[model samples]
Target: MVSEEADSWGLGEGGSRSWPTSKPERVDDQVTVLNEHRRLSLQEIDNARFSWIHAKICFVAGAGFFADAYDIFAISIIVSMLGYVYGNEDGNLSPWQSTGLKVATPIGNLIGQLVFGSLADIFGRKRVYGAELVLMVTATFGQALAGHGRAVNIVDVLVLWRFVMGIGCGGDYPQSAILMSEFAPIRTRGRLMTAVFSCQGWGQLVAGLVGLITVSAYKGAIRDASYPAIYPVDCIWRIIVGFGCIPGLIAFYFRYTIPETPRFTMDIQRNIAQATRDINNILSARRHTVAKGLSSDTLVMAPRASLADFIKHFSEWNNLKVLVGTAYSWFALDIPFYSLTLNSSAILTYSNFGKIDGNSPNDVYESLFRICSGNLVLTVAGFLPGFWVSFCLIDSWGRKTIQFMGFIVLTVLFMIMGFAYVPLNSTGPGQHAFIFLYCLANFFQNFGPNTTTFIVPGEAFPTRYRSTAYGISAACGKIGAVVAQFALGHTLLNSNKDMQIVLEVLSFVMFTGILSTQLIPETNQKALEYLSNESQEAYITGAIERGVPLYA
Candidate 1:
């Protein structure tokens, strides 16, 4: 019967060679059959060559990240413009309002990661993927239209819309990472994941460029003596915020069209027929002839995952330790990472790198331009290169070593910048020195913990719980971001007296991240099944008992 079904499907004699001739008569045989099917499905994915389909997957996943980065980082620039239009005597965002604006998205992000991450695992990746992008597009437009009416305060409206946008952004993190990781061939899985994440650098760059262009375009209006310094009240910042929706819109179609990853379809959903069809479609699209020739009737659904199952799987000390390591390392990394990246303009301004000469409209415009320009230079010099370096070396040098080095180096840089805060901010040469350290810190962030933290969670967990574990780890990181933005950013970094203290604390945080790195096992040049000891043991034992070759 199996041979006939395989023949009818054009699989021929070779295709049915290993398929069981009858239903498994015993419990262990049943388990072995199901495990072998899953193992083969994953091995197929891991060994497949790179193709245009892979590129499509990367772009579809990457576009969400681009939008995420643009929306999150654009706020920093917009805040500067807001201060110009609605400046009090201080002519800057008050620490309280700044904290609210910065922290709202992360709060929303925490909820999104928890909700959507679990949903992806339960409902399947394709079903839950594009909805977040839609939410983001709507919220981004709302943010642009915010403050148009007099009834609500502008900051409150922004806080509301941005918080919702943050949810969408948060969803993208797990969805994109897992989708790309699942689709990627093992030989370049790390690089592929890194490639998708590298979109963040582009988004950061675009944010700065948009700020510079919009502010520059409106410079003439600001320079008009007849008009007040804030004459074009809604023009500049609205344009900047509104521009973020473009990438999401462009990527929406592709994201919606992307098929469910074969691994998810087979391993989690336990639908071998559909999984095989999807894989064949991908191969056909890529002009490859290999097909799994799996029969839907012969394949049985795995038990649906539940909370109890989740607990049972992760309760083991080894699995629990991985979760802990990923969560805490991300937390420690983001404290300094978010605080620095989100507030780069403020830092530069505080350092007098782009000081405003006067309260004139022209002066304000130029200062915004200079600040944007400074950010662009730093992002281009340090941020983009770091991602590319990781892209090149992630699969070769391995994740653990790079992450450890990054934490160590970043710790030293922060400590130096912290203790020498007075000197670094004083003379011209000192300012230059401080800027170099800051840029270098940004470099190591992408080259090390920032990129690795995001990648590790997606790879380390089993498919049934991959999205959920990734989400939990990510949410923990956002918790760190919230603390940094609200707790440390608002309180300590707000005033000059406490700036050094903030840096010193961040240095300590990075060092602690170094300790957490010890918990992560190296995953270089290994298949996903081999990453976790349980999965590796199952694959090895199953292969031996069934008299089949591993990776076959």
Candidate 2:
């Protein structure tokens, strides 16, 4: 049956065809056969039953996100401690210094997304997966060691090291998302992707908890009559930042040990034997069945991807439009997401959870506790629950609908908070009300765009370009993060009506995201091939030639 199907599409005997020395003279016939074989091979993955391999993939992939979030968010706690230790008598960071500290990692993230994303496409995902973790582990230790010397300023050292660490965090975004997406079955793809991404919430939650515990543990030391106030607080930040390395180290060996994705083997390398062997090995251990019909003898190789090929492939309007939509929507979503998230300490201060006026050691400890406690509250109440909600509903609700709903709700919440900032900030009860709305906003973000944006780009593109497209989309989001940290954050801090204006602007940004969401097609429960125009065209052509109905 397989041979007959191959022969009908003009594939040579045993489905092993010679590589043409030049561009195919008959593009349609060649493309149809290749896509058909790819469709069948990938479908096996899509239809496969739930197994331990899927769970293993999710854990290995999710560890990266957990580390990324922990590293990124630990700074929020560290920043507050920095103000206590290094701030001028006023106990505040210089606006310029704060901006640099906040924006540095995002700049590195942008570069990493572009560089590592393309590298994964060219060198293969397995080859590139764990390299980032090594950078992360090294840079994390470097961040802890910062400020140990009197000659170098702590903030400068931290900014430099965190920027390097950010590159590793950035690389994980595409590497994990594409890796899990390629391995997941279609029925659970959204849930599996969300499972990996949901670790981000825990990372944030753990960051807050760690900050709370670390500072509390040193509370007695801060109150000691002999030690300087700066001494105990300085150690707090280092411990929090250094703790990020644990998850990365735990995940590194597993990530490195995993085989290259089966899709990459079949679709890019065109090595059916290796792809089949890998798939069957996974199945034998986890599914009690093995892949059948793939020849173990042939080693067919697809043309290597190049800069020109990338341009030619994406030059088509259909391909370009999806890329633009994913990129722009992610960019739109991250503007407010990162701006608010990265600066949650300031928001908590504004909400009156911590003391803004304190120079004494006892006062510093009290302030640190309050801030860390507030962050923990927000994480537990808002961030973690939001992620789990999305994890539960993303597959059922569909990515587009959930994203649209999230953006719209976020728009309304931001507008309310923006327009009502003065009244809300004025009274204790009003502030509590404000925090509730803020938590709801966080919930919608996770249940909405945050989870969907990551999942969609991972699944929407063809396997050959999946990581590259995810990288571009993620890179654009980081650009938004950079703009938020540097541009909007700076403006909000400088402006007289800081909270009001920031919230209003973020509301407007969310509204624009709704418009961008329209460009992306619904992807829930669909085959990856159906999402790619090139593959879909070939699949349909081959189906018709074989007298199979279009639906089949």
Candidate 3:
């Protein structure tokens, strides 16, 4: 080897020509080079064979997130339909009740995330993924058909079904993120996970578009009658909420074809040979016709993991460290995220859409404009820039730094909005500017902590407990959502002062979030399967310590 590179190393002519074959250091260096070359060769072979297959898997896995977004937003859009439907005849329900339809799902989501998330942790992603799709599809379609009967009050049924669907939608967050993260190549894990999550923007956009069209469909009825006829309202709502079922159907088909994560099949299942053969088949298929045979069902033989064993490896000190970090970070992150999102409808009502009046010149137009414009702005301006930032700088800027910066900025904006709300009490430029600033704050929130909190749990955990760790962390996030749903949306929106108080509280939450972020280690260069037992224990215990239990 030295002779071949003699010219480059200047080993020819007067230079020493003999390689240090007798030296242990030189022997070690040679072995290192050979091992590196062999590893690279295997990786190259795998890439050559399986790139397209992995891409297909990513696309399929990503669909779950898309559906989750659509389903979640679809429930929100159904609010307008309900307000039009139920408010017409008896006028018994308040505007709050109409909005409650939107609120009910997140309430359900809190339960679903805890329950289904636990199941995913116990059963594995593939089984839960399929089960969630089935449940969501069934419940969603049930919501659609519930109004078909003449005597049935659609409003009650809508709320009932949404809560059930929420459970399924809620389950998707952890399962989809964990599943994609587990299967992704170490080098591309961040991008792959983000890609799956980024479908959320698409889902929100779909919801807004559906809202736009549905609102327009009922505009005449809404304007002509005290409340639109219940029949038209019910029909429009059924169509809108039913949109959620599409992604579930697509996810079901995709999961049937896709194999479970090789890591999960190997590490958790302990089916090393089957895992190896699966990887080989993926690799072999890259270059030639690999047999399409499924491996023996030996992957399922790994004894079901228990909650006791789940926490079995945790040492108290390290466990507490992780528990505090994950739980605080999630809580901090959700305070701003959920607070803003839950109040989005209220924000639009009072924003540039021309004040919160039942009667105004451009009220309908303004409402439509706010929904579409905000969605477009967030989808294009907020989410795209966030994705770009994460893509370009996540490795370089680091997660903790970016997250802290985002929280600080959000806190400042919330403070401004709170002050602005105190004095600028009317519909004017002050309110307008503050709303724009608030929107800008929300945009940044999505770009930063909103995305990072989800990312951290998956990356911070070891393979053995990755699902459990994320499930518990994600359940914390929903607790934040539940708080936001009940507190910010319903409780705070009763008056402008309430909004100010809510924003003030959120400022404190964000500050705490920034502080908690200090505890988490940077995961930029870490491999998914390589987290330490101590770190894993720290993550779980830390989460439990800080997290208010979902059940409690």
Candidate 4:
């Protein structure tokens, strides 16, 4: 190899070589240094013992998801409240307007995923991490403050702000998942990521708790006369929507100051020396500060990311399959997941849960109370437990195993619910059985594909494309949510037999999800590099001195 390189360069006259300027030996030596340092740091990260840093990273990154979920689902009951405030004399929002309000967030999420997902890769995670939370916090507050403009009703204002908040909500999926994946130890990585993603269950539960609390707080006014007292009803929704921002506000500083993953600092920035120093500070001392002798000029130019490089990497079938697997699995899972979550009130009402008979203010109070209480019960009975169960088993049982099993169970549950809808709703006891089945579906979703889809994409791709790929995958899931809200949600609001058909459709989607799960290789207890399916040798090709970029 040396003789061939010498022959190619014609370094033969007296066997003397060009020295100092653009020295070939310098490039080779730098490659060796990059390889050695990168390998050591990655080993340290993957095998490092569990510590407070891991816990801190889990919660800080996860706080965004909690806030996002709270805002997203809180709108379910809030839509009903807005109906009292903004709806016409009929005390109802037009079906189109209601769907639009509910669908806005998923639309925003799709945009945020595509935009911020790539930005984090191009700039840096730390720079992009807290940015979406800003959008969430600001837009959430904006929703709380929305009022009736002469031309635009409060509903229109809410749709606008919720869409913006949705974008921020969407951005959190990739950002949080990528951060946890990059920072966590391999053995405990799945559990840590699960712990982070499980915040959604708690968020949903709290949305209901807050909804129930607010409705009860205004109980007297709601029961006094005709429709729910408009002022208190307005107050209820605002309080719930406004409260969603508190978590984001609290975690904003920590997220902004969060350390960049050593993987990104090494692989994307190409600074292995600095990356090693980062691993030491984070793992050894649990501090986010960088070591001394930091240089602004250092640039390790090894396989820099580009449009062509990204295309080439994922073009391989092995790589492309995983991306497809994660994307479609999420898409399928969310078709049902969001269909149920975003429309839980409608679905529960369809189930005749705590049904009442009159149209008076007392009737409205009883109905809204039932909706809030039922949501809380569903969440407590199903969502929270499913999340913790996944948390406990993710590391041991493996992601694919749990996903496959969950999908299978979910498919069965949906089929039974759809096929037996008439019989299930025929009797009071049967309706109770139907709700039990409903809760079971919720349980399997969190315990199954819902959690794993978020996890696999974050870890499956290479460091350079990790955030971008996860964004794409998560964006696809949001697309499913959008479709469900726009198409199925609109249909289900009819409160008819359509839910039977929706359940059937969900069954089919879950079955397809099962097929997609076949494509996702098990990410259980595996190193991120192993999942990337890329060669590791000679990872450092060269260096760019003094702020010159090797690849734009």
The TM-score leader among the candidates is: 4
lDDT of each: 0.80, 0.80, 0.61, 0.82
Per-residue lDDT for 128-172 in model 4, tens only? 888899999999999998888788878888889999998899888
Q: For candidate 1, lDDT tens digit of each residue in 1-552?
A: 112322332222224334333445564664565555555555567667798888998998888899999999888778777776665654576777777888888988988898899999999999999988988999999988876347767888888998999999899889999998888876788999999999999999999999888877887887874434775635888898999999999999998788888878776766665676677778433322222333453334344579997888889989899999999999999899888888887788777866375767677777888888988988998899999999999998889999999999999999999999998888999989989999999999999999999999988888888899999999999999999987677764366657788889899999999999999878665666566545332332222112332222
TM-scores of the candidates are 0.90, 0.89, 0.78, 0.91
TM-score of 1: 0.90
The residue-by-residue lDDT of candidate 3 on 331-405, one tens digit each, is 777755665664566565555442234433234334544555555554565555666666666656666777888
Order the numbered candidates by TM-score, best leading. 4, 1, 2, 3
lDDT of 2 by residue, 283-373 (tens): 4333222222224433343444677968887898888888888999999999998888888878888888855666777788888998899
Segments of candidate 3 deviating more than 4 angstroms: 1-50, 88-100, 148-153, 217-232, 283-305, 352-356, 359-381, 423-427, 534-552
C-alpha displacement of 134 in model 1, angstroms?
1.1
In angstroms, what RMSD does candidate 1 have relative to the true structure?
6.5
The deviation in Å at residue 389 for candidate 2 is 1.0
